[model samples]
Target chain A: MRTLVDGQPGTVVPVDDRAFLYGESLFETVAFRDRQAPLWSRHMARLDLGCRSLGFQPPRPEQLLAECRKVLPESGPAIARITITGGSGGRGYWPAPDAPERRVIQCRDWPGEIDRQRSAGLRLTISKSRLESGPVGEGLKHGNRLVQVMAARECARSGHDEAVLLDQAGSIVEAISSNILLVVDDQLMTHPRPVVSGVGLGWLIDQPGLDLRLRPVAGEDLARCSEVLVINSVSGVRPAIAIEQYRFRPGPTCRHLQSLWNEQLI
Target chain B: MRTLVDGQPGTVVPVDDRAFLYGESLFETVAFRDRQAPLWSRHMARLDLGCRSLGFQPPRPEQLLAECRKVLPESGPAIARITITGGSGGRGYWPAPDAPERRVIQCRDWPGEIDRQRSAGLRLTISKSRLESGPVGEGLKHGNRLVQVMAARECARSGHDEAVLLDQAGSIVEAISSNILLVVDDQLMTHPRPVVSGVGLGWLIDQPGLDLRLRPVAGEDLARCSEVLVINSVSGVRPAIAIEQYRFRPGPTCRHLQSLWNEQLI
Candidate 1:
């Protein structure tokens, strides 16, 4: 893991940084390829949207992009994270009426199974913990993530690759880190929600003959699906082999999202 | 503001630090008296409780005390902050099982008119935003704070000194930063929900004469109060002079809490 602070290489943060104090910040994850972040634009757009939605001004894009260029080695796939915060303050929730301090970070060597899993598939667990629902803050990767953190812990404890999260109202939102898309017969239908549906799922929907379905998907509906794919930037689109005993054979729709993702990124 | 990273005088937080990524952390705000912090023990206890709740193997108590000693050099009240996180190999939210990274930070300053105003009074605006109410991660000053951040922003925009928050069910919680207490004639009262009665508020209640009346304090009920005080660690206690059009002068209860608070800290 490497971090560049205000354009120079460094570590540690301000004591009063509101990100740590209040979780008053926004963050994004991007896929790095050959010394460059492939989905940098998408990640930044989402970050910008989140900051605005929550009322914040992030660091200038060029400054962030330049810093990212310095840290990302000309190499294989890795994860690049950008966090912009309202900076440190006293024991008050009101932000200092000024520009927030920005924190951009990148972590190297994760899983080492990106290509292997893309070729094979992943197994998911239906998490008892639910993703937050409502219009105020759904979808974007804001800093307050107690629910997702719990769900991830649950998946690791249960010996599963990931967990599928339903909203508080019992509607499928997304997996812990990836979006869930089901393939039935030839249709690529995914649970639609008022919450997050970011670039990865949007790209998957754009694939030809994918037959994207946007409706409520309950955990009970998994038994009727022939194939399922969990989507995220790091993992692209991987088929779901089993969701707790119900097995899914990898289908062509899964392969199609993969090929389209490759074409889009590489 | 002066920042020293591991005794070096400057500002730059390491990017790989877990507090930046996972929001896995805790902090303590010790109110400064001439050259030392008042109620340091209570603050330390709350920080420890937060660590215990977050499941972070607590750090050496002496080390944190030493960090505070190293930072304070003057005779003015200030806020001392400490953060501990499990990071490196940074899985974003999924802390690496057993990585312990702690950062202790101290800020030297108090807000404007905090002491003087506590002697006089304050005005509070009831916020429409609701604090996330639950046992999963409630009350601990962990970083899941977008909820409070939004409420704080509205407080600033609305031109109010503080904002009273409620739960999803319209139950009164606390001010954005302080524990709320309303006095009707003689008996003192406040809402006793854990989400609002964080460690700071809990300690404030144990003081004699300032008996805590546990009841649901609604928006309608607040207007009928003869005196109100927004209490917290740093501020101690400040009488509520006005809320919208409703007003109250500093009375016996507010004066008693203020004197008791001064005796305890200043």
Candidate 2:
């Protein structure tokens, strides 16, 4: 993977990048095909929402697309990472009177190899952890990610591939990194938005004939679901077969959504 | 300001610094005095605690001390920053299996002199903003500081010097970066635990004849306090005169604490 700054071969961030000092940054991961990135528009919109939340000016779309063009992987499947920070010289915590630098980075290939699970599904465990979010930071994905890190660590130590974090309101929010979708009878059910609002899953839920409902989902409700699926930019849609003791077999919804996910990319 | 990496003047940091990626780092802002840092031990302990909480190994005390001596500022006050990230590479969220790279930075001196209010005190407006913390991250002072940044911006726009952010429980936790101490009915009380376990103010509250109680302080209870003081390494202990409409004069307790703080520094 190569790194670039403003469409160059090399770049190092300033010492005072707000993302380094205060986590005053936003990031998005997109999937790449050949040397091109799919879902580029969706990723840009999310990154812009994050920038708007931080009150930082985002870079021009043409510039961003140009940079992405230069650094996207030339071969194989890769992950594109774009990060923007409230750049150098912020007077301690507040944004300075002057404009700050904007940063963009695109790296090739997610270091993680998940093809095995993509074909065979993954085992998920319920997380005791909960996500705390409100209007201030609910929809936007800024760099304040320690809680996500905590949940991820918990998942690693608990011998599971991922964790299903709940919210303060005793409802399942989402997996630590992806959105959660459970097939309930003939309908699709996911937790309401008191927790994180997953960007990818939001679109999937909007697809017609899905019969999606936003309701408070508890652990008990999982036993009643026909199947469960998780979605993310890199992982796309994959079946979740086991949530701790509760088990599930791949069902029609999981297979259908997976096909739709692939179709959308094309 | 002198920038050093691996004990020499260096401008480039290895992309592998955990602090750069996951914010798997901790830092301290030591008050520089004539080429010496007075609160070095306390600052170092907090750094060690941060590493401990996040499960990162810390630098040897002698190694850190030597680095501090090597990079002490030439003149004026400075903010000493040391960020340690769980370095090395892996696809998953688990910490890399290696001794992490540590980043040490010492700002020669804070740009643009401190506001004149360090001694005269500044008006504070209790913010509707709140901190994101709980049992896991309560007082580690790890790199997840976007909450503080958000509160600082709120202070700037609202025409206040600083903000007192509430916790998830709606209990007054702290004033963005400092510990909040209140003189209530001739008693000094502070919120306990997850609000903030600030090192400097925690030491001050331990002095004799100090009726320091760690309790959940509601917004209403705080606005009625006799005198409110915010404490940190830079500010020391400055008595807050008013919060919104509630007013406070320089009470005896405030003066006493100020003297004690001065004596301790001397």
Candidate 3:
């Protein structure tokens, strides 16, 4: 990966950084096309809200963009990860409030399969690894992602493209790396609890004609939905081929969202 | 802090390391006295269990010890932290199963006030930040410690020595960095759910005469306990003087445990 730690071209960060030590940090993954990140503002807004929630002095968006620009490829498509962490700290969980937050910006080659998988429809499996709700910074895209890591591992071993995580109450929370959207009762909806406010999902729901609703999705509801889709900043929008035994064809709504996504970013 | 990355003297790790990227790691904090780590074996045992649970090939205890010794102080008291992480990976949560794990060992000067505080007792306050239960790898001392960080911040800001965390059901889980033991109904007990399975607490309960029972401790039960204590490898054992409005004096059992700890380590 091409990486920068605090704007310098490097791939290492101080081991004592609280993010490395305790996972006390926030991050955003953006997809850049021809050096332009269409969802950059939404990603930054989420990061800023996360900083305030976690009590870190928010870094200016312009400053973060400058660092990201340093590592972002000048042409074609790429993936940019912006990580903000409280720098090195003494041996404890208590962070020094005045410590300057550090940023690690990394750029990676866009996954070549994303475009092919978008229309092909990705496979999704329900994972035994559940997302714990009510942890501090619940909806924020923070660094404490072991749950997702484990789920993703399960997906890889099971030969599925992604894993859908449920909550303790058997409610569908999200996929390991994306948010869930489904057409139930012919209404477009997403879960209201314990999920990252996905940048791509946010953009999709905010489009001029989409009437989006928030509802708790039970695990059993997967089989009932006519169409299921997973959305994220990196993957944009993807139709799901199957969620366990429940198979979903790319329905009209799914194709419409994909077209909207392509029109904006492709 | 004196440090070593995989037995080599360094304070930085690759930014792509899953430990830094996704909090996909296990860690143990040990207190070393005169270059001796009394709880080293227990810590290693916990780390081994964690590695197995997380599907990482566990590093040999001897190798980890050699790395710790490289950074441990030649004499006097110090704190040693051993972190094991799945090394650098690509742009997703699915860890490469064959990737070699990395270890970071760090040693720090022991807090000078620990000896004074052992007998003086620590003040504990209930925190608004609750620990989420049922996340995969629940009881492992993993790198995802944001919940504790937020609780510790609450303690530091509230002028208390530690903060007590409760699970979603309002049951007492543990203090910010330690496990809780209490004398309720004149029987020594500890909560059985969603805690780190503290090494120091294990040693104490294993002593010849102490009978330890596992029970779920409700938040309302603090006031009914005869005495309350917190235990961890780094802190050894400490009497807690208060849990919010509930006051606890160092009772006979607490003093006996303290004497046993000193006799074995000091």
Candidate 4:
């Protein structure tokens, strides 16, 4: 992988960096095709909001875009991750007001199996661990993600492709790494709260042709859904084949959405 | 400060270390004096429990102790922090089963004003940011400490010595970096739930001479308190002079406890 730290080439981060020390950081994983990130603006919006919430100076969008462009593959599909840390500081939780921000841009090969998973559908399971809504930085993708890490570990342990997470109220929040959408009686239904919001889901929701509505989704609501889908920036869209004992066939709606995402966005 | 990573000298951590990537790690801040950590065993117990909860193999206590010893000053007061990360791994939240645990032992100068703070008492305020008890790892000192970080930020912004946090149920949880105790109606009360358990509080509770009792402490209960104190491994015991508009004097109980702590433990 090609990596840059604050636009300089490096692989080592300071031990006292706030991101490493106190998890004071934000990141965006953008999928790049032909040297262009489709949802760069949306990713920047979220990153900027996260930076402000975490009390760090947001990086300029042009500079971030330039750094991402520098790391993107010459002409192939690649995933570029931009991590902006609150920067190195003293051995304490209270961040220095003037601490400089550290930005890391790294480009790696896109997951080769994304297409296969999108076409054949993914196997998913419900996670026993529930997401706790904090007073701040709830929807934004900040670095403190042990809950998601634990949920992903559960998915791996259960031998499933992904895991669905619920909030403390047992309301369906999102997938471990992506946002979830369900089709019930031909209406697209998703959880109203963007708890663990996904950049890909934001982009997909803006698409003109999709029938999308936000509603509180419970386990019973999921059971009534005809199709289940997950979306993230790196993996544009994938259908869930099974959630526990319920199995779903790859549907035409998902295929059409994937095609639209690739043709117009990618 | 002196530093070691996995028992070797190091000042840099890998960018992809799970601790840095997803906050998938646990840590302990231990107080050391005269070449000894007073609450070493208690810290190790908590760390081990956290490791188990996070699905990482716990480090041998003997090895961790030895590392801490290596960084301690020959014969002075110091603070040693033991950070056990899930180590480096491939680009995902689900940690590799064989991922090596990374232990970082760093010794730094003990806060010089701790004694002064203890004698004069601390100015504390209730934090607006409430701690959400998670389904798992609620009491563990995991690396995902954004909640505490935000609380500390609140304290800094409000110009208070520390912030007392409450859980979702409006029960007092802990201070930003320590556990809290209140004396109400001549009865020593602390929150029953170890929401943010501290090694110092655990040690103090086990001491035979203390009149500590665990009960759910509410906001109204705090108003009826005669004395409030915060305890942490680094800052043995310090009285809270004020919480919002409520004023508290440096009571004899806190002074007596401090004397006992210094004489018997520290």
Candidate 5:
């Protein structure tokens, strides 16, 4: 993997960086091919909105792209992660108003297993852990992800590819690292809030010939869906074979969505 | 400020450190006077339990203390922070089972404002943010503190010393950085779970001649309490002057607890 911290080639960050101390940061993971990030706009839009909401000065798109290009491969598939953090400061949760934003762009080879899992379908389990509700930065892709880390550990222990997380009210929110999508009555649906809104899902929803609706998926509602899909920027679209007891097979809609997602990566 | 990463004097951490990436870490803040950390044992007990729960190898007490001593002042009050992270690794949330834990010990001057607040009493406000519910590491002092960070920002904006956060069900959990204490009917009451089990509060409860009860505090219960306080290792005890509309004054019980806390600090 290669990294650039604020355009400097380094992997170390100051201990006082608020991201390291209080998870005061926002991040985006984009899948790129031939040094081009197809979802760059979507990722940046989210990052810009997050920076404004969190009170950090948003990075300029031109400079950020230049930094990202420095870390990308010449002509192959890779993953680019852009992290914007409240820069190093004194000991406190309230960020200093004058503190600059620390931008770190990292590039790594796309894991081959994601492709295998995408093709073979994923074995998923519902996690026992629940997420916090309401509009408290839940839709932002921020650094405070201990809940997802624990849920992923649970999936790894259970020999499952992914784990589904629910809110305290038993409403299905998302997967460990992806957005939850349901194909109900031949229409695609997903949770509206209390989740990190996915860049990949947003792109897919914008594409022509797609029928999408935003709705909360209750625990019982999982059984009502014909197919359950997990979507993320790195792994475009993965069909879930089973979530504990409920079983599913990759259907025509799943194939159609995968084709649409694949076409853009090229 | 002075820092020792793995016992080496440094202020930078690798970008891949899980604590920086996924908030996959636990931390403790200790207030030391003349090189003596009064709540070291309690902090270590909490860290050990958190490591076991989250699957990290907990650092031994002796080595941790030695590193902390390297950065402490010889004769004045200072704040020491011990951070244990899932050390540098590949791009993923699930930590490697054999991955080594990273220990970071840092010391800084104790903020004098805490002393003023403890004496003058604190203006508190109820935060709009609600915490996640259930037994998902709510009582642990881990690095996943974005919710607290945002709530602290709210307090700063509203000109309050601290902000009280409730759980999704409107049950009072804790303040941004301290545990909540309610002096109700001549007895001290605090939430049993859904709050960072505080070392300072623990010591106060364990001391002689104090009545304590572990119970949930609903939003409505705020009016019933005659006094409200915030307790933490760094600040000891701070009486709340007000929480939104409900008013409180430093009463006899608050003074008694402060006296007991002060006796040990010396």
Candidate 6:
């Protein structure tokens, strides 16, 4: 992977960085094709929202784009991840008033098998760990993601491709990393809270031609779905073939959305 | 400040570290005096508990102690902070199964005025941000501390020395960085849950001669308290002069505990 710290090539960040000590950071993952991150605007929008929620100045989109372009490969599928931290501060949780924001952009080769997972579908397990709600940056892709990390670890341990997370009330929240979509009665339904939704899902919802409804999803509601799909910027859309014991075939809605998502890559 | 990363002198950590990426880390701050960190054992106990909760191997206490000794000043009051991260990992929350643990030990000059604050007392304000419960590592000093960061920011903005936090149910949790104690009817009381209590408070409770009771404390209960104190490894014990509109006086109980805490420094 190639990395740029504050637009300069480097991999190390100061230990006193608030992100390092207190998880005071936000990140966005953008998929790059032919050296351009097509979803850059959507990622930046979410990053800007995150900065606003955390009370930090958002980095200029053009500068972030330039940094992403610098690290991305010239002509292949890659993932560009941008991390913005509250920068280095003294030994405490209170951020220095003048602390500069540190941005790290890293480009890595996209997993080739993600395409296969996208087409063939993934086996999903219901995670034992649940995401906690009521935090200030609930839906934002902020750095304090220990819950997701633990859930992903469970997925890996259970040999499932992904883990489905629920909120404290046992309502479906999202997948470990992606936003979840359910085709219930041939209508696309998703949870509406932007605070908890990912940028990729936000983009998917805004795209033309899909009839989408936003509402809370209960576990029983997921069982009633005709199809289940996970969406993220890096993988676009991936069908979930199985969640626990319930099995799903990639329905027409899943295929249509996948096609819609893939169209942007070209 | 002087730092030792993985037992070597350094100030920067890899950006890809799980701690940096996902707040997959734990830390303990030990107060050092006369070239010895008297609270090292207590810190290690909490660190080990955190590791157990997070499913990582705890570092050997002797090695951590040796490293702490290296960074601490030869003879003076200082603070030694030990941070253990899940080390460097690939571009995802799922940590590499074999990822090595990274330990960072940092030594800094102790705040000279904390002693005065302990004696004269601190002005405390009730924080607007509330701590969420039900996370796996709730009480552990794991690195995912955005809530504390936000509360501390509020304290700084309100011009208060500290902010008192409440759980989702409006029960007292702790201050931004320290555990709270209330002398109710001349009996010391604190919340019992390990998930919300600080290591400093844990040590205080274990100290001989102080009668400490563990129970949930409501905001209304603070109004009935004879005295209120906050304890952390860095400052030992500090009296809280106020919490919102409720005022407190540093009673004899506060003085006795402070003396018990200071006795260890000698």
Evaluate model 6: give its lDDT. 0.84
Q: Per-residue lDDT of A1-266 in model 4, one digit per residue for the tens? A: 48898888888788778788777888888888898877888988998888888888899989987887887878989888789888987447777767798998878788888989988889989999987776778898888888878888778888998888888778777898889988888888788786667888888788887788898688767778888999888888899999998888768778877898889777
Candidates 1 and 6, the one with greater lDDT: 6
For model 1, residues A84-145, the per-residue Cα lDDT tens digits are 77776534667877755666565455558767878778878888876656325667777766
Residue by residue across A1-266, what tens digits does model 5's lDDT show? Answer: 39999899999998888888877889988888887888888899999999887888999987888887889988889888889998887446666757788999988778888888887899989998887653367688889888888888788888888998888778888898888889878778888774788888788778887778888778777777899999988888999989888888998878988998877665
lDDT of 1 at B228: 82
Going through the candidates in order, what is the number of backbone clashes in each? Answer: 9, 0, 0, 0, 0, 3
Candidate 6 C-alpha lDDT tens digits along B103-194 = 99988788877979988999999888877775568778889888888888878888899988887777887888888888888788887764
Cα deviation at B101, candidate 3, in Å, is 0.5
Angstrom error at residue A74, model 3: 1.5
> Which 10 consecutive positions of candidate 4 chain A have the poorest summed lDDT?
A89-98
In model 6, what is the error at residue B111, expressed in angstroms?
Answer: 1.4
- Is candidate 3 or 6 superior in DockQ? 3
* lDDT, candidate 3, at A65: 79
TM-score of chain A of each: 0.92, 0.92, 0.95, 0.95, 0.95, 0.95
Q: Which segments of candidate 6 are over 4 A away from where they belong?
A: B194-196
Candidate 6 residues A194-224, lDDT tens each? 3356777878778887789998788778778
Query: Which pairs of residues clash in candidate 4, taking residues 3 or more apart in a chain or in different chains?
Result: none
Tens-digit per-residue lDDT, A1-266, candidate 2: 36665456664665566667667777776677775666677777877777777777877766776776677766777766667777777676776746565565757565464666666788888777667774266766666666666677778777788888777666677887788888777778887773445667766766787778987688778888888888877788778889988888888887788788778764
With a 3 Å backbone cut-off (N, CA, C), the pairs that clash in candidate 5 are none
Q: Which candidate ranks first by DockQ, i.e. highest?
A: 3
DockQ of 5: 0.62
Candidate 3 residue spans exceeding 4 A from truth: none
Instruction: Give residue B249's lDDT in candidate 1 (0 to 100).
Output: 89
Tell me the lDDT of model 6 at A253: 86
Identify the superior model by TM-score, candidate 2 or candidate 3.
3
What order do candidates take by TM-score, descending?
4, 3, 6, 5, 2, 1
Question: Where does model 3 sit among the CAPRI classes?
Answer: high
